[model samples]
Target: MFTEEPSYDVLKTENAFLRARVQELERALEACVPRESAEEQHHVPYRKIFDALPVSLGVYRRDGLSVAMNTTSLELIGGIGDEIIGKFNILEDPSSISAGFVENFQRAAALGKNVTMPPCAYETAGSTLATIDERTVWTETTYVPIKGDAGIEFLVECNIDVTERQKTQKALEEKHALLQALIDNAPMSIFANNLEDRTILVNQRCADAMRLPPEAILGKTPRDLLPEDRAEEYLREDRQVLEKGSGIEWESERVRDGKPYHILMTKFPLRETNGKVYGVCGISMDITQRRRAEADNRRLQEEIIRMQEESLRALSTPLIPIAEGVVVMPLIGSVNGTRAQQVMEALLEGVSRHRASIAILDVTGVTFVDRQVADALIRAAQAVSLLGSNVVLTGVRPEMARTLVEIGADLHGIVVHSTLQSAIQYALMY
Candidate 1:
């Protein structure tokens, strides 16, 4: 992390204000002027505090020739106050010339208007002088005009070091630029709006979604980009998020590029440190493809279910007519409770529909019979007999006979035949 700027540079505030009020110094202007001897200057009115002030201060004639230097100024110039006093001229200083003081000299120094110059490095430190500080002093200098009888008589010079403050401000600008880059490159649409319903922030993705650039999108309301109905709906949702001070999510449909898309949107309140809602933030993602895939999967599942039911129906009760009063029921696959029930229904229905005297069930293709299958067969025979028909079972396998015997199935009135043809012949003879 970057180091924070120190509060040292702020001392110049008081120095600049009090140092420039030359009217107070005007009372002692005659006395404060530098004399031939240094010992007598201390006795001048307001001389003690003015020299002891913490900032760099100097007095110069309207033409910019140095007249006097404060205690701080003497320390910065090094060696002795008598050495550079009245010799240094601000108009000839390299930093001041580059700062346009040479061009604007009269209006600033000779006139009554005070002017504060931009921050610049001063070479009066250890560069040429024998001062203690080895580094260059960066300072903001101010020239205040002191007025008297005919016109402006003198100018008061004040300087404040501002090196750290300058660096801190530049550092903050760099951090803001870096954060802006990251937000612009994000994939999803992100935006925020103030309580006035004006857009305060928007990512590049959101701007592109609205078919506008970031600058065009910001400071605009929902109605600026959308139809009246849609805009009102969006604003209403934003208000809800702010009122609730919580997040909400839902799916909505939006049209883009002449096609409808599903958007998964979420809105939340942006709060201050005091927990007051200031604005609303929103995030949205396109989910049209995902929604389409889910719908396709549901259709496929329904189709598969229909196909399975058809296959089970075809497998359960397959029937064929053999003669005018006889029908044949062919059984196949392993029998379950549901399929067994279908078999019984088919047999009774066929006997009544055909006015058949016999319903022959061919179990040649049947797998091993369980108790459920055995019970289904007996019930079918009894039902057919009640419908004025006789039940004949043909082609019983050895396993089928053994299972029926083991289960002690009671098929007392049902007739048995060797094959489907023989059962049909017997029914014809009857």
Candidate 2:
């Protein structure tokens, strides 16, 4: 009976499985070997099995000369000959010496223990001659010292390339440092507090605002340093953030030295990598100066309004000297109690200042007159009379006279005229 040879696919699958098993053993060996223990002796056939595996491995005598090396190790040395197999000394190699591998191997041999160094730069002559890849390579190397019955026998060296991983880790560290610098020097007050109410982080502005040094602020709760009310308020807001699991923006107030300072504050929930809420992060900016500016603007507006009203009141009740001894007061717009009082005061003041004997009040421009205005006019007439000047009412329409009668305003001693021209003629003739 003839047996069929193994299929190519089956042989390929077997080869792959063997390779995976060898890699697994490599990792297991790395873990099982204690760092402080000398390596136990292995059977001679085991070295040939390790040589068949696809990794760089070699055994070196205590004197640093190569005793045995795998095919992969021979390939890494750039050639296979007496110069590589037995004469190769990693300690004497210029590349290994410069790359720190030689020192690590020496240390392992001296201690009679295993030494592992990760992400170190090591380049082999074979790799440099073969490829156009990076001149510098990164690796995680392991050195294991083998001991025999007599003393130290050999040192096993293993290497694993990790160039990409090292580069990625370096980039992440650089980015984290940049981000930390930005937050540390930010302009606004910023803080992060854990659920236990302990301060985890604070920026320069936050320290300045609290009037405390950074060393004193970190790792402490707000209640430890801030005022009672303020600390309570911060805790309350933090609780809100935790409950909502989201961000909130609001304006708040802080009192210092009996003065109120306004602040715009933003708070949000901080979460862990697993998406669980852990704490609250907050940022605040002082808006006291902005609010003060708004208040000042309001006061300025009120002042402008007051000035405008005064100007209009003066225009509405102008007292003009029409003749040598006669003065005319023209009343316009709807007359109110306040304007009537002003009218009385202005008439008296004009009489005293201009020294006019006759005062004529023209009400033609006045649209409406109330009882308060009629009383005010009578009072103004009485006041002018007391100043030794006579008051004549002119341009009194029929409607105004009816309104005066209806209001029971007694115009007993006051002389009346139908027009301002008639009043002027009467005052000049008198």
- All models, RMSD in angstroms: 18.5, 13.7
User: Which candidate ranks first by TM-score, i.e. highest?
Assistant: 2
- Write model 1 residue lDDT over 344-390, tens digit each, in one string: 88887777888888889888888867877777777878888888888
- Candidate 2 Cα lDDT to native: 0.85
> Which portions of model 2 show Cα errors greater than 4 Å?
1-89, 93-99, 111-114, 118-171, 209-216, 222-237, 240-267, 287-295, 320-327, 370-379, 413-430
191-236 in candidate 2: lDDT tens per residue? 9999999998888788887788888898899899777998998899
Provide the TM-score for each candidate, comma-separated. Answer: 0.57, 0.64
Clashing pairs in 2: none
Error of 1 at 230 (Å): 2.3
Highest-scoring model, lDDT: 2
Q: After superposition, how far is residue 293 of candidate 1 from its true place, in Å?
A: 6.5
Output candidate 1 Cα RMSD: 18.5
